[model samples]
Target: MTFENTLHFAQQLDRNDPLRSFRDRFLIPQAGGKELIYFCGNSLGLQPKAAREALDRELTVWQHLAVEGWFMRPDQAEDTPWLSIHKRCKDPLAQIVGALPSEVVPMNNLTVNMHLMLTSFYRPAGQRTKILTIGGDFPSDQYALETHIQARGMNPADVLVEIFPREGESAWRGEDICNAIDTHRDTLALVLMSGLHYYTGQVFDMAAIARKALQAGVPVGFDLAHAIGNIPLWLHDWQVDFAFWCSYKYLNSGPGGVSGVFIHQKHHNANLPRLAGWWGYDEDSRFAMTKGFVPMAGADGWQLSTPTVLAMAVHHAALQITAEAGMDALRRKSEQLTAYLEFVLRNSGYPLEIMTPADPAGRGCQLSLLVHQDGKRLFNRLVEQGIIGDWREPDCIRLAPTPLYNTFEEVWHVGQILLKFRT
Candidate 1:
């Protein structure tokens, strides 16, 4: 995988990419008929070419059958039907996140799912009223945790413990997080953080953190919005109490596509109270006007309304592509691609700080660049050259070369462009 600074190096890397075939699998938008070098998949992934056709099938079914589509089966001889649409997508979702099919379910959007899981799991009582979290967590997570605390009649200032990086440091170490849990265990109700830091792309120690929190008599959950398809996760083995993720990023589902959830098998029969809805009731007797709410055993019990069929269809279409290519293979190429970028960027000596952790084990496909000056101008310049990356307010620009479709050649070229920006 030796790479050089010339256009030939990029073409050569593209030539050797085993997953290069996948680039054609997506819809790369072009301006004036030239393909843009897309590096923003961390925010919104490129559309799968099959997504439109999949959505059209449902549109056709709806247009022709109207309300009858809900009850009608697509294949009468088998189980394929509109009613089972959510069920159709669950298996592939589970595989992407490394959980059993029964342990995963397509449900509300990310924040909504977080709120639902909090209701069931955040049973704060006695001294366990504080929620321990990292300082640079995504804004949505911070808001959800605070709101949930306020709803429970607690002051967020006292109940929220924010673990921060050491003085003169940029990222929180795993030890610091565990120490925060240990120091505040008696008052910490939940230890929550992103499976991967949204800005820095630093992968957290979920397994170790979950074990530590559980040992300290606290529940641990994760917002996996950035990590689900970008890394190999063992949610079940890690004993994560619950987790949630949106599908539009590495999963390549279209914007506002349906999200998913995971509730570990250990909690299935536990009398943990939940904010339930009609959709969580047993499907077998749902239409029979059931007497009481009997939740459908596993993660499906967390559903509120009928699944969003159209959104789920988009996810189903995207997951099928990931399922075919396999997550492990995607991750393998991902490490190589990111490392190549890091290597080139570091050597270029750009004033931009490579804030993403260096170890492949501690991060994913994305790298957060902190440009020292004119960061916004530099971002605009990259865009002018057909390079697409997202700017996170203040100074950071995130570029994720998604392995399922992005090529190593693109990574090298983007790195060279960043170097050019510095001088």
Candidate 2:
């Protein structure tokens, strides 16, 4: 599809877009009585207009029912029981991540879930005591891996095989990642990688990476904090061992919303050790409060505490929208939105380098730009213009035009701003 650099053309594309109306459902940000072109979905998504109502309903339930809200009555079939509030997210979360309902459980934040997954999967035995992962990964993931290794009484420098890109390259090459997995396969106890790189917006080949590690007899898992909702996933089909993600960003579930995990049903009954909590005890025997710890079947067994109902309420509302839009539709729109953004930026004559992959399939909605001279000043000018993209340190002006809320016109207008700003 050829793109034209005109407001009329952008507007025409928006008018014909199937997902256009979905934008109206969100509350857009405004500055000085003018709407800002929000390209910061990679950081935080705009609030869903329905989020308020979702919260209010849950608050009312707490007011009216108090402790009774935890139990479901035979009378009101529609009641969202607090005992299983997070369960409402399972099917939608499953559909989003391409996993079976039994394989998904929406619970704690991303880092907490990552810690839990690390506890179960990062079993260091004999000579195979290392974890293979990407270098310059998201800070939280880096910290989690570093601290987890330290907690297990191993020096991170010795136990972590961090695969970094070549000096001139901005992204990790597929073969490079695969080779790294093979290089340390014997000493590697786990292959922990981000499904999509947060800094460069590079989407890793999860299928190939997972296959390589598993074939070499090493366990693998992904941190999908930047991948989920922005791109389509098939964790079940891909046979990914386990994965976790936050519901902010592309998922649009308010700030620090609940996170979820996918554990293949094959491991549901496996005697994998976990950091146990009362909430994860077998449901039937949970109230019995027995002496021994018998975990609930599947991913729910990893849950460490009571569900965050208020946060999950927002997540439930937000996920309902994603489920309704469908991942295939979202992916299509995401590709187009990103491609159009790239086309506009490339043609704008802006002195910036795209740090993300050129191939549409190798990225999600984000396109990170490494600006040239006066980079910080240029970013500030755009912010003053109410063009809301974020500036990451070192050198990155990330613009992520979300499919659910952003439009082609906004992308075109951003190009216009850059073009005029130079003149």
- Kindly list the per-residue Cα lDDT of model 2 for residues 1-423, writing each as its tens digit: 999999999999899899998999999999999999999998898999999998898888888878887885334648468898878999999999999999999988999999999999999999999999999999999999999999989999999999999899998899998999888988999999899998899999999998898799998899999999999999988889999999999999999998999998888989998899999988887999779899988898888898888898999999999899999998998899899999998888888999899999899999999987888898999999999998988678999999999999999999999999867
**TM-score for candidate 2, residues paired by index:** 0.98
For residues 220-309, write the lDDT of model 1, one tens digit per residue. Answer: 999999998899898988889999999888998888878889999999989988988898998888888767889987999889998888
Give all candidates' CA lDDT scores. 0.87, 0.91
Off by over 4 Å in 2: 73-77
Give the root-mean-square deviation of each candidate in angstroms.
Answer: 1.6, 1.2
State TM-scores per candidate: 0.96, 0.98
lDDT of model 1, residue 186: 82
Could you give me the TM-score of model 1 versus the true structure?
0.96
The CA-based lDDT of model 1 is what? 0.87
